[model samples]
Target: MDAVSEIPDYVKRISFIDSNYNWDNERYGDKLQKWLEASSDNRLFVACYDDANALLDGKPFVSKTGGTWHRTYLMQRYLKKKMKRLSWNKTENDSIIYFTADNRRIQFYSRKNPEQKIYHTILVERNGYIQSVFSGTKYEGMGYQFMGRKVYDMYRQNSGSW
Candidate 1:
């Protein structure tokens, strides 16, 4: 396995919020920093645990992977369950979150099985504090996917990603 895959499940989740965000932020932030800076060799580990707990408790998901949101086991489970009822051709029957390198696409993968060979796409747009989401299928003629193109035309007459 790769080095990243070797990290414990819990340690895979980490959040590095700036210390100047809110009340008691300093104390909490300092504690987090201490764990993160515990040792360079295991830095990712400490942060992952800290971030995982924070996320499980309802805080925003954070990651050193440059992702805007983190995905926990619970969230993954929930997504998987939701996907079953959504009627999308999914090959992987597990719940997964996909965050790209450029941070342009943040996707939640709902699989019908672990292989995730095929699935639906749910697109979401986020501003500073609000998020707008849309869902669609992979095949337009199949009626299982979203008719994203039709929705786009209502607003703009130009071509869309759908």
Candidate 2:
């Protein structure tokens, strides 16, 4: 099983939008910085899960060992570190935002899930105001229960008519 073929369909669909742009660019950097500064106190939901367990945290979360929980924890840490650095890029319409980082060899159980993959982080600003970050792995699906009704409603509404 080649790695590329093993990637889930959903992951492949989103691969095009993965952060290829240089977030270090001055203009994008400024916009990202401003957004981060304004959103410093806003609520953030970190939802992670796998075949057997799920965890949600207001702050970043990560597991110390390699297991179903490792991906979620790694994602949390990745997002937090990126937020601290303000390392993100905006889409052409400025409606969607993204951040990505190379996993390197820091993954849990490096023997199996080697660190060659890239983690994709996604964020959206609701009603031109509040911003929320979402990260998840390809297998177990992204958990959304942690987001309050208002936020969930906003997400559903903006997401589509469904």
Candidate 3:
């Protein structure tokens, strides 16, 4: 449903007076700088628990937040682990998670589950605020499987790595 709409009047009416923009503008630089400053040992996590939490963190069904703006335990863990690939000492050549400027989306590919074809991604709005995240399926209640196994499987990630 997120993509099936027509642009109103051929131009989308988007408002920028939002807290997500302000929150990102204030912290993105500092967090990015901190990530860049981390040593080879890489102690500080760029998208740390407290850091990656968006302004719409606890909110659901946010318009710009990748559909239902849902958050699952499995999705959160995968996102965190995949985000670590953004740290220094990591080479893009070996990257499974890639950032594309085309539409400002961070595409997460499950290398091992290339056949799963879940189509997961995080959208970084032009404002540089990471707001939306589509974790493969629309809703966990829809029986979305990671690697043919249920998300309830605590070790489902072992079935596929994003």
Best by lDDT: 2
What does candidate 2's lDDT look like per residue over 51-87, in tens digits?
1222334322333443323443444344445556534
Weakest 10 consecutive residues, lDDT, candidate 3? 42-51
Local accuracy of candidate 3 as per-residue lDDT tens digits, 37-91:
3432222111111112233434422333332112121232343444565422221
Best by TM-score: 3
- Which pairs of residues collide in candidate 2? 62-73
Query: When superposed on Cα atoms, how far off is each prediction in RMSD?
Result: 18.4, 16.6, 18.5
lDDT of each: 0.26, 0.28, 0.26
Location of the lowest summed lDDT over 10 successive residues in candidate 1? 124-133
Question: In what order do the candidates fall by TM-score, top score first?
Answer: 3, 2, 1
Model 1: per-residue Cα lDDT over 67-153, one tens digit each: 312322233233334334322232232342332111111123321223312111222111100121211112213322321333332
User: Which ranges in model 1 have alpha carbons more than 4 Å from their true place?
Assistant: 1-62, 65-69, 72-74, 78-90, 93-122, 125-150, 157-162
Off by over 4 Å in 2: 1-17, 41-162
Report the error of model 3 at residue 132, Å: 18
